[model samples]
Target: MKTSLPIFVRNSMYALRGGFLVRPLLISLALGLAGMILSSAEERFPVVSAWVPDALFPSHADPQVAQVMLSTIASSIMTVVSIVFAILLMTLTLASMQFSPRILVNFVRDHVTQWTLGVFLGTFLYCMAAMPAARSLPQPFAPVATVTGALALALASVMGLIYFIHHISRAVSVNHIVDRIARETERVIDELMPRKRGAVARGEDMEFEPEETEFAVLNVRSGYICFIDTTRLLKLAKAHKLRIRVLRPIGHFAPEGAPLFTVSHKSRLTAELDRDFRSAFGIGPMRTMQQDVEFGVLQIVDIALKAISPAVNDPSTAINCIDQLTSILIRWAERAPPATIFSDPPYVVRVILPWPDFKHLLDTAFEQIRHYSANDVAVSLRLLRAMDDLAATLNDDSMRKEVTLCGRRVVANCATRLDPTNLKRLEDRLASLEARSPSFATRGA
Candidate 1:
């Protein structure tokens, strides 16, 4: 739905939505205002907090007691908030050094860390906002209801701090990191591809073809294509009765003065029309998982590669990454891919866009890891099983054939590096995998 909006607005919303800004800012403001409002209301009607003396603290006449309590809670909450931030920074550093630095994006967008910072700071502000109401000259008003509310918030902050420590402990583990990335990738797949696999054969799947057009739109800005507002593009094309072909797909970089897209018919190209066309692309310096599933896959692959390298030699970690990658591939196979050729009328193609197909996504997910893990028997065996799992889930023959080829490549790569017994293990898995695909099974028969 974000792709439906204009480019700059969507990009700004995405940055605010993904970082630690929006949620915490809104929460802190809301609680601070609540504290002020509650204090004012207590002054108008004293019955609201009238029972505080008999019930909780037994200091109804003493405004000094309320002031000290509010001040101490506010200062202590600020101290604990500093500790929370220090823990978060430490976690991000450990995750980057141990696994992959690319996963820092995931940690930045983590819900637990964001919420932990929000509640602690929010509690501190609540106390500060209510502190002024507990003044000696102001009719000796203690604002008992406001002080009681602050006490409740201080208790919640203490419990939240404990839970945050527990969460950060698990967040640094390699398994949790990869699993989280795979889950996020699958969520992106669901949003980008809505239909189920068997419900509709991926229709209008075509590659980009070169053809001369009347007008070539040059990119004014330079960055990676984080998003392509396809809905806006199709609307503009249908309105003008022309064909527009995007030269670069999502996650591609377009330097200034490059041909970003071409228009089939443009007798008179106005500056307004050109600006509208360029605004459909959301460009940024860094890649994201918004419209790019491969970005997510690469994050996990980075970890797997580091795991199997000569220095770390962490096969267990590599195998865990392989299993998680297989899960992501399965989700991809079960969903219909994005429509490459956008049509307005029944059969007329108005907008031509390029999306990464199954083969491209498959290779992006596994090709590098397969090449690197050729010598490790445990990691290699896991890769073969991953291919088999993906092949079984694929509904289309072309995708299955691609999976079959990848399986053979794994065995071939391992054949040179692995000993006889280890090589035989991969071959056996490949034969079993080939039996399931009709092309491979028929060829053997």
Candidate 2:
């Protein structure tokens, strides 16, 4: 689909942020250019190298020594770059096999690893780009200033390499990966649902019924709906005096020729209008965290499932996942639902969009993990406590009731597999979950 400029730019920015290409490429190229410019300047103005220590490069008039040093540094850096890349690839392979392949996004988006790649490659480029300046045929000239910069970069690369290794060590740990996912998910929740707790979500459950008069906009693209430019969507609807209902959920796949959206009045829909509506959407081959909160939850769920699997039964890791999921649920409970009905003016709905409610998110976050961990006492206890913690943060009775019901489900599932003593522990936790401050919701509610 052809997206509008703003929408395209946003998708591009997200791609750049998540991938390994753009940032490292930019950094390496910038450093390479800096190397060329510094070398040229020092060649013309030898005074630029006056501050260079005599011990480091004894003579500025000697080109052979500078060339050899530059060549050695360049070759050494290239070798290091290959080793670093190998290490990174190994880490990615291990993480994907052990946890989830989806988390590869997090590793690629890591700033430390990216900088490490860039700096190592940049140092090599700097040396290569400056080596030509120390040419004997050019009357014995050495760009000491440029070489010094390369030396500094090489040293910096060494330190960065050390730090990158440390980062990867911690990053591969299940605790760190789970926390990073949780934090990123919380950030998305904050951005999408900014309102404080207890604020009522307006225009929620605003369903649009299909009518014979409505016109369907078939999707020409086949991919997940990575982004939806709501501003464009609302403006298009208001200007055409039509009510628009997006037929597919954001972050979902819309097959080719499938209906993407529907307009209330077919008379107002034209060829150009169809293109504009399509332009408001951005489709990609995979789901992204740009607007998909559930994607993050699923990533963690994947790890939790693997952790609790018979092949790798790690209850402590499962408990950590529950704690992070609890953090996310609490954050979600506090934020207002995203705006669903967009109106140009007051009391008039032009665009009807729906977001994942607390119930939907609650299921997405905990249901699978809860089901899988029902047998493990530590994991089961954590799940009950997580449910209790999620409910306690909210003031909405209905939402709290939903959480309590989920807790009962947890208890029931645990009962199927737990001893009497363990089941009683869950029963006690359920009692507290069902009864909280100022009279909580009852089981019948």
Candidate 3:
């Protein structure tokens, strides 16, 4: 499915600020303020003095035991709230390790500022309430009692604060652990599940012959497919005046150990052919379907970059944003939902709704691009809103059906409204562009 970068960035910002940091701060502040107000009213009214002994404190009646009880409960609630915040922080840190670390760092910085202020306000309220009660206690031990009471409250506040900081720090550290694990896992997989010599069929037993006249194999890696230079193939094709053809083009599946080509080379050495094919295809150097999916996603990102460049110019920001977009798309494609049993075609496009929902995803995607550019909230939200539309549509069966119908109508309309000459002009420009920069120019070639 297409993505709206703006929606992604807007949601990310909200996720980072509103979830872990701002929300907790607001809750803490509200509770702290209420506590302070209640404490002040209690001090002024002197309602709870009946429970304490009047002889030890002549002017006032004994303070109610319930006030202390209530204060203790409030303190405990705040502590519990602090724990919830700590857990959220830890979860955020762990999830970020799988996707993006920068998101976690921003969460920490925002949360620290807001939570620290909240903790201070909360502590102040606790101290204010407890101090008055401590002062009313009997004579010789009065100063010692006040100090002890205040110290206890202070110690609790400090401990809560320390735990918050420690949780965030520890959560952030877990990212490194995840990274090391991923690297080691990839290394092991590369060694164990080595690329098969030839493509594999979907069926368990169906073997197929290679359809290409000339062939070469190469290993595929991110952003590139390393293959046999094709220098040997070209020489053979030209010298023999034979046509060159691609048997299993880049993305199609093939049976393992299937012949890539049948050489019609006159007077050719079988030993050389055997050696080259074994050395090249044996290592499974050819790009797989997964690689093609990644390459397609990367192309979309490049197109997105062009669409958003400042002046629609800042190529650097565009380049960086595109890289991030590519990474996101690759992850998305890998985890795309399984096709439903009733689905007519297993293609992702068929499953996705057209128009607005599509628009929204694009908008969310754009938000991310804009974030690195100028971080405009309005623009970002607009994109997010669009994404919300898409998500809503996808989740709604009626809306999805309407979108499908609308797409068919659009295609029908295009056939009538679109001028053949205009289409040719557009196609020519695209072809020219691809000739110049094959990697980023075309959607797929």
- Please give the TM-score that candidate 2 achieves against the real structure: 0.95
Q: Looking at model 2, which ten-residue stretch has the lowest summed lDDT?
A: 436-445
TM-score for each of the candidates: 0.93, 0.95, 0.27
Best by lDDT: 2
lDDT of 1 by residue, 1-445 (tens): 3333567787888777778899888888888888888988888888888767667867776789989999999999998887768867886887798788889888878888778778877878888888888888957988888898999999988888889889888988899999999999889988998788766544474443344465888898789899988888888888887678788888888999998998987674566777777778888998988788888889999999999999899999999999988998888888877655456455566787788778898898889998998888998899889999888887788888899998898998888788999898889999988987888985353
lDDT of 1 at 349: 68
- Tell me the spans in candidate 1 whose CA falls farther than 4 Å from its real position: 1-5, 198-214, 442-445
The superposed Cα distance between candidate 2 and the true structure at residue 381, in angstroms, equals 0.8
- Residues 88-186 of candidate 3: C-alpha lDDT, one tens digit per residue: 667776655433443443344454535654665555554445445434456211222222333454566578668766755664543332333333323
Work out how many backbone clashes candidate 2 has. 0
Error of 1 at 433 (Å): 1.6
Candidate 2 error regions (>4 Å): 1-3, 197-201, 205-212, 437-445
lDDT of 2 at 185: 91
Q: How many backbone clashes does candidate 3 have?
A: 39
